[model samples]
Target: MKKWCDNAALLTLHGNTVGMVSKEFVVSAPGKIILHGEHAVVYGKLAVAAALSLRTTLHIKTIHDKDDVLLHLPDIGVEVGWSVPEIAAAVALPVCDPEKPAPPSEELLQKLKTFASIPHDSADTKTLALVSFLYLYCAIVGSQKTLTPLEIRIESKLPVSAGLGSSAAYSVCLAASLLLHKNLISASGKWSEKDLQLINAWAFQAEKVIHGKPSGIDNSVSTYGHAVSFTKGSEPVILSQVPSIRILLVNTKVPRSTKTLVESVKKKYDKSTVVMSAVMDTMEAVAKECLILFEKMYKGKADEYYKQLEELIYINQQQLDIIGVSHIALEKVIQITKANGLCSKLTGAGGGGCAFALIRPDVPKETLDCVIQQLSLEGFDCWETGIGAEGVTLHV
Candidate 1:
């Protein structure tokens, strides 16, 4: 992954051309991991997250007309055109005119209303991803902001709704692109660590428009461009490098919806405090243990650290299984990986998306290849990728 840039500029047109087409900023966001906390994180439990190599990239080019805001996602072959008049008409609410400014706190609500009025489905994963970004861009610029016709095209290797945080990656990439286009970053130079944090926070806010209450782990890791320990209320804390920990991401492609899974979990939790409290308490302990393992590894106690981390991952996976997020394919992948001498578990929101395996440093490349082929034969989409990727960054 490349570093962020600030010297982005517009491509000059011929003398006769009136509009300046900016150099397209290709922004990319990475997939994520739920190292410790999964369901418990929703209730504000701590969780460790890492950026994955699988990423979503968005390409943005400014166009000329107010009615020509076009969005295209080539990977899924989705394209949409938005007219300015249509946006204005859709946003004119009964309580306030489209032409007038609303109060500060209500600003976000009004923008949300505009988002709801736009013809997009919360159920359509890719469309929700697109509209969330567009809504943020339009609202951040406000009514006085002039948008030259713009065309945005997204292409990704990340699978949709597959627990890889694909949609969050799309949202973060889109947010970074629009921010770069609007000159929201510091003018002095490349994006600083603080700038990346700001980007992640803003991206998390954008995702709330879609997910209703996202954990913020996905966007935070994606924006920071590296592995982090994310807690919803606190800032993401970066982790130091640990070479022995290698991650494998496997897709079950079961096509589960996160909302449905979350609702199911919520219902179960609401019905039984003893059961739910015990489960969440277990997850919280695992997160704390994982953190201790990381600290030990960083402080040169490698042997004990690996053992504790592996235990944490194994126990966490089982908890997710008991909570009803693990699918048969996920279990199969975990079994195969473990049989091949790797520590493996489920990643992301569970239900039926992706599983993760922590490979031993001594494991040969052939073993990894064999595991991938074995999974593929069983009709699983297997991918081996590294952790510790850079978060969201813009390419000029």
Candidate 2:
């Protein structure tokens, strides 16, 4: 609910007078973490996710003389440019309608992949990032007569492919910036509910391009900000009044496939239907209880609430292990954090992407420092950040 877009300037480009609007600005959106419920969410169970303080920012600068759009992702050392006319000529962009977002068809995706010169079998970060950018840019801009040529440079504090919703954050920023650039949304203070919903819809389309299939939770949190209680086939219940909480976000740096993890959990479930059903039910209960505690904590801070939250964290982590998604590296993180009087659980798809440890408000600095030092010595990356951060916003 803060205002950052107040400076507006007019410029003359190519002997033509341009509109009096800010042509250069920055837009940012926060990454997300699953505080409770990971694989269980796949089973139509409840899950809780929050927007992380770590965010992805996109700087958009319009170029009047240029005929191409440039995308530079310095964090990943990727730089790609596509000619505006060529993109228009090659891909058949559908009509622009934020209210009714359509997923990219296989034909459209294949055309883009070929146009971008990406290998057909390649689904790497760079490839997906490029495709997502092109898909959103073309879809949002549509067949407008004047296609704005711009340079977009990205910088992110969140780690890529770590199950921290980095891609979703990136997509949200793109949607917000493109909407602003086209003047489809207001450039004033906080965006209205209608505008935010539009942005979320477009961002979800981009997420489908980046990820084969995704729950709407990541983009919803990135667009709406704060915390959300989500279940499959239902709209995310936003927790607007939830207070921010400090935690240690640890990255195991061990790559794992989310599809594989989900399938593994399914195999376990199929092997023991009754037991796995109970495990999933318990996970859902953990999420439901955590949601209630979050609301109560927002009303008034209580030590008892924190204690109960930590207990839920422990229970959820144990459930994840029982479901066979936990790896040795994740267990090591849990062990390290528990030894230091903190409860930790693997976020996202588990099997060694990232884990978060609850850091109580009363925790001693020395204890926190020791935990960090030990985790660092073991080659794991850790950061002390808060959850329930603001969502996407335009910068001056």
Candidate 3:
């Protein structure tokens, strides 16, 4: 791989020094869009997800004699650091210091300690996701001499908090970078199924820091970098070997909290068995349809495959609407897209995140443009993305 030199050594942004670099690794994780299973995935139903082109990259470099780790989050203007030993100790320590206000548990403290070791006084724009990665790095690789107070730089192509699983991509990239730094995965070799599983496991564990209770789809897709049939609390089932198909990711700047959405689902689930069962059934059907569509398309029947997929997409959106997760922006996009007979649906945890529109090959450019214009008029942020592009990769 070619090295990308930013020429930062000659131009220090804030008096931060660059040391003799031992090695640097670059890793990427794919962004994701959910077709259905917003609240249903938690109950053991399948969700159809595709990997988006947007990704997050982590640049990890080792430095000499620098007890201080530096994090240069240029995208978020965060530069901070802490001593290596101190951070490890912090993670090992319990939160309750007895003298302090309820010390953190030994496990939780250990994770926080590793996070504080990040090279920055304040967390960056992607701090939560980075912290999750740090915890995983310390756990799997151990805080040995091989890992030291280092500088990490992050760049993300995905929009943060836009329902594109940006945090998942960040965590997955961080885990991949740390593992590569430890030489767990060969730089030039292909990763085996076991290697992918290990990476996914580590990434999922790390995701806890960003999301209190992640369903694993975000990390799984980001780690595997392909469309898969993901069921909560179950192993991911790879949908195809050919990778995901192309789609449009329309982001609604309106932010939605995953915790809130999850809680909402839980509340409704406990209140109405009928509603919950219906939502889960819809999700299961959507998942099956997506799988069938993939199979049909793989067999060289593109038109029929798209037709089925579009119908499924519409049905999935209707389910989301029934579940009260769909936002006005997402619904508007769906209406506009469907008005032109296009396939579109909410992609992630609804309630104002992002949506996806499956485009037919024969659809006229004018129709697509009209759909986009209508969405734009409704204040939706939309863009085209290739599916199943690439999973996590290291850059040196």
Best by TM-score: 2
Q: Give the TM-score of candidate 3.
A: 0.80
lDDT of each: 0.68, 0.85, 0.67
How would you encode candidate 1's per-residue C-alpha lDDT over 127-174 as one tens digit per residue? 556556556556544335454456777788887767677777887877
Per the 3 Å backbone cut-off, how many clashing residue pairs does candidate 3 have? 18
**Where does the lowest 10-residue lDDT sum fall in candidate 2?**
10-19
The TM-score values for the models, in the order shown, are 0.78, 0.92, 0.80
Error of 1 at 114 (Å): 8.6
Task: Please report the candidate that would top lDDT against the real structure.
Answer: 2
RMSD of 1: 6.3
Candidate 3 residues 1-396, lDDT tens each?
Answer: 122356644212121233222355456778887766666787888877778887787766666666656666555656666566776655543222211122124457345744555443433436665566456645544534333656677778787777777877877776666655555655542677766666777677666666656778788888777677877667777654533566777887888887788788788888998877987897798887777767767677567677777777778777777777888777777778879977787776788888888777787889888878888888877787778667775443
RMSD of 2: 4.7
lDDT agreement of model 3 with the native? 0.67
State, as a TM-score between 0 and 1, how close model 2 is to the true structure.
Answer: 0.92
